[model samples]
Target: MRPPYFIPADRTIDYQLRYFQAKQLHQAVVIDNNSRAVGLITLEDILEELVGAIQDEHDFA
Candidate 1:
Protein backbone atom coordinates (compact mmCIF):
# COMPACT_ATOMS: atom_id res chain seq x y z
CA MET A 1 0.00 0.00 0.00
CA ARG A 2 1.22 3.50 -0.78
CA PRO A 3 1.22 6.22 1.80
CA PRO A 4 -0.85 9.30 0.98
CA TYR A 5 0.77 12.68 0.57
CA PHE A 6 -0.27 15.48 2.96
CA ILE A 7 -0.69 19.23 2.53
CA PRO A 8 -1.85 21.94 4.87
CA ALA A 9 -4.85 23.97 3.72
CA ASP A 10 -2.97 27.23 4.08
CA ARG A 11 -0.22 26.18 1.65
CA THR A 12 -0.21 27.75 -1.78
CA ILE A 13 -0.98 25.80 -4.94
CA ASP A 14 2.61 26.24 -6.10
CA TYR A 15 3.92 24.67 -2.91
CA GLN A 16 1.57 21.76 -3.32
CA LEU A 17 2.78 21.23 -6.88
CA ARG A 18 6.41 21.43 -5.81
CA TYR A 19 5.85 18.83 -3.12
CA PHE A 20 3.93 16.66 -5.55
CA GLN A 21 6.70 16.87 -8.14
CA ALA A 22 9.57 16.46 -5.73
CA LYS A 23 8.01 13.51 -3.96
CA GLN A 24 6.46 12.09 -7.14
CA LEU A 25 3.23 12.18 -5.18
CA HIS A 26 -0.02 10.96 -6.70
CA GLN A 27 -2.59 11.64 -3.98
CA ALA A 28 -2.66 14.21 -1.20
CA VAL A 29 -4.78 14.42 1.91
CA VAL A 30 -5.49 18.06 2.66
CA ILE A 31 -5.31 18.86 6.36
CA ASP A 32 -6.93 21.52 8.49
CA ASN A 33 -5.25 23.76 11.09
CA ASN A 34 -5.63 20.97 13.66
CA SER A 35 -3.84 18.49 11.37
CA ARG A 36 -6.97 16.59 10.47
CA ALA A 37 -7.70 15.56 6.92
CA VAL A 38 -10.50 17.68 5.43
CA GLY A 39 -10.20 16.71 1.80
CA LEU A 40 -8.28 14.67 -0.71
CA ILE A 41 -6.58 15.79 -3.90
CA THR A 42 -5.20 13.59 -6.61
CA LEU A 43 -2.79 14.22 -9.46
CA GLU A 44 -5.68 13.98 -11.89
CA ASP A 45 -7.64 16.52 -9.84
CA ILE A 46 -4.74 18.95 -9.84
CA LEU A 47 -4.28 18.56 -13.57
CA GLU A 48 -7.94 19.20 -14.10
CA GLU A 49 -7.80 22.21 -11.83
CA LEU A 50 -4.89 23.59 -13.80
CA VAL A 51 -5.98 22.76 -17.32
CA GLY A 52 -9.74 23.18 -16.93
CA ALA A 53 -10.82 20.76 -19.65
CA ILE A 54 -9.29 18.22 -22.04
CA GLN A 55 -11.05 16.54 -24.91
CA ASP A 56 -9.79 13.16 -26.13
CA GLU A 57 -10.10 11.95 -29.69
CA HIS A 58 -10.42 8.31 -28.72
CA ASP A 59 -13.86 6.75 -28.73
CA PHE A 60 -15.34 5.27 -25.61
CA ALA A 61 -18.16 2.71 -25.38
Candidate 2:
Protein backbone atom coordinates (compact mmCIF):
# COMPACT_ATOMS: atom_id res chain seq x y z
CA MET A 1 0.00 0.00 0.00
CA ARG A 2 1.08 3.56 -0.52
CA PRO A 3 1.97 5.87 2.32
CA PRO A 4 -0.88 7.90 3.79
CA TYR A 5 -1.22 11.63 3.21
CA PHE A 6 0.68 13.92 5.52
CA ILE A 7 -0.56 17.21 6.88
CA PRO A 8 0.84 19.83 9.18
CA ALA A 9 -0.36 19.95 12.76
CA ASP A 10 -1.86 23.36 12.12
CA ARG A 11 -4.08 22.11 9.30
CA THR A 12 -7.76 22.78 9.64
CA ILE A 13 -10.20 19.97 10.37
CA ASP A 14 -12.10 20.57 7.13
CA TYR A 15 -8.99 20.12 5.04
CA GLN A 16 -8.01 16.96 6.85
CA LEU A 17 -11.51 15.55 6.59
CA ARG A 18 -11.68 16.24 2.88
CA TYR A 19 -8.29 14.71 2.31
CA PHE A 20 -9.28 11.63 4.27
CA GLN A 21 -12.43 11.15 2.23
CA ALA A 22 -11.04 11.90 -1.21
CA LYS A 23 -8.06 9.67 -0.72
CA GLN A 24 -9.99 6.90 1.08
CA LEU A 25 -7.06 7.10 3.42
CA HIS A 26 -7.12 5.20 6.66
CA GLN A 27 -4.02 6.46 8.37
CA ALA A 28 -1.15 8.95 8.23
CA VAL A 29 2.20 9.36 9.84
CA VAL A 30 2.25 12.69 11.66
CA ILE A 31 5.68 14.21 11.19
CA ASP A 32 7.60 16.56 13.42
CA ASN A 33 10.11 19.39 12.89
CA ASN A 34 12.91 17.12 11.74
CA SER A 35 10.70 15.59 9.03
CA ARG A 36 10.24 12.45 11.04
CA ALA A 37 7.09 10.62 11.95
CA VAL A 38 6.18 11.51 15.51
CA GLY A 39 2.76 10.00 15.64
CA LEU A 40 0.01 8.36 13.62
CA ILE A 41 -3.42 9.66 12.64
CA THR A 42 -5.95 7.17 11.49
CA LEU A 43 -9.34 7.85 9.92
CA GLU A 44 -10.94 6.56 13.09
CA ASP A 45 -8.78 8.89 15.11
CA ILE A 46 -9.59 11.81 12.85
CA LEU A 47 -13.31 11.22 13.20
CA GLU A 48 -12.90 11.12 16.92
CA GLU A 49 -10.68 14.13 16.82
CA LEU A 50 -13.15 16.16 14.79
CA VAL A 51 -16.62 15.25 15.95
CA GLY A 52 -16.18 12.59 18.54
CA ALA A 53 -17.83 10.24 16.07
CA ILE A 54 -16.95 6.97 14.45
CA GLN A 55 -17.22 6.35 10.71
CA ASP A 56 -18.92 3.36 9.19
CA GLU A 57 -20.59 2.74 5.85
CA HIS A 58 -23.95 2.42 7.57
CA ASP A 59 -23.46 5.83 9.13
CA PHE A 60 -22.82 7.62 5.86
CA ALA A 61 -25.44 10.12 4.84
Give the candidate number with the greatest lDDT: 1
lDDT scores in order: 0.82, 0.76
Against the hidden reference, what TM-scores do the models get?
0.75, 0.65
lDDT of 2: 0.76
Which candidate leads the pack in TM-score? 1
Off by over 4 Å in 2: 53-61
lDDT of 2 by residue, 1-61 (tens): 6966676666677877888899888887777767787787777877787778875786866
Estimate the TM-score for candidate 1. 0.75
- Residue 13, model 1: Cα distance from true site in angstroms: 1.5
Worst 10 residues of 2 by lDDT: 3-12
Report the lDDT tens digits of candidate 1 across residue range 1-61: 8877789989877788888899999888999999999999877667766887555575354
